[model samples]
Target: MSCCSPEGHCSSAETAAVPAPGTTTVYTVTGMTCGHCEKAVGTAVSALDGVTAVQVDVTAGLVTVVSTADPDDARVRDAVEDAGYELAGRATAAAH
Candidate 1:
């Protein structure tokens, strides 16, 4: 699915480029229902150090994170929690 914010445009932190040696991870997030929820999750995660991009899929409860380094699981969990959602755990490496 497209990573836009449901406004037919690229979203905040959803288009940043990761530096070298970076990795992308898709974490399962629960309790997101709409664009605002998606923004909350994306903003929180995107604020982290080394985070380069964030794409939230409310329909699938997925948050794809790209960073200049491997993101720590605990930090991502905390970010999601701060966004008022639960991190269901890592889903997989981000696809593209």
Candidate 2:
């Protein structure tokens, strides 16, 4: 069953079945000076294939993404780059 039903609600049956683990990835996004920058980073990351969700903390300069597909550092980096930001090294464990 799909993770979310057509109505955009998660069904009990779907919830009962353990979903694949989602990997948490963090990226140091540079050149983000304001909320817009954060939004841009989030939008770019969320647009990636297999990206389930994205959260950004501007103060921390951190961008986190949850995805079922194996987190590709290069892909994440590219996404940040495409958004006009520079991506630091691979995410840290604690951030994940």
Candidate 3:
């Protein structure tokens, strides 16, 4: 599924790259349904200090992120869970 907003813009859902010094990792996420879920997931992920950008696809049931700090799957998973969702699996970076 695509991640475009209503204003005719291509969404970052399928993939995204945060070019900050310490924010360049990707993760796979699960258990998202509507935009609210996406917002929750994004909020949880973005709260981390090193996290710079987050992309979520409710239809695809995935979440991708880029962070400056070392990949912290646990924290990421915890954040997702905190947002009332499940992580489904480990999040490995495609560029890590």
The top-ranked prediction according to TM-score is: 1
Q: If the candidates were sorted by their TM-score against the true structure, best first, what order would they fall in?
A: 1, 2, 3
Going through the candidates in order, what is the number of backbone clashes in each? 0, 0, 6
What are the RMSD figures for all models against the true structure?
6.0, 11.0, 5.7
**Candidate 1: which stretches are off by over 4 Å?**
1-21, 92-96
lDDT of each: 0.78, 0.71, 0.69
Off by over 4 Å in 2: 1-21, 94-96
Q: Report how far residue 3 has shifted in candidate 2, in Å.
A: 36
> What tens digits encode model 3's per-residue C-alpha lDDT throughout 40-65?
78888889877878877676676767
TM-scores, in order shown?
Answer: 0.74, 0.70, 0.66
> What is the per-residue lDDT of model 1 for residues 1-96, given as tens digits with 9 covering 90 to 100?
544456676423242333444587888888887667777888899999989888787777878888988899999999899978999898965522
Between candidates 1 and 3, the lDDT winner: 1
Off by over 4 Å in 3: 1-23, 91-96
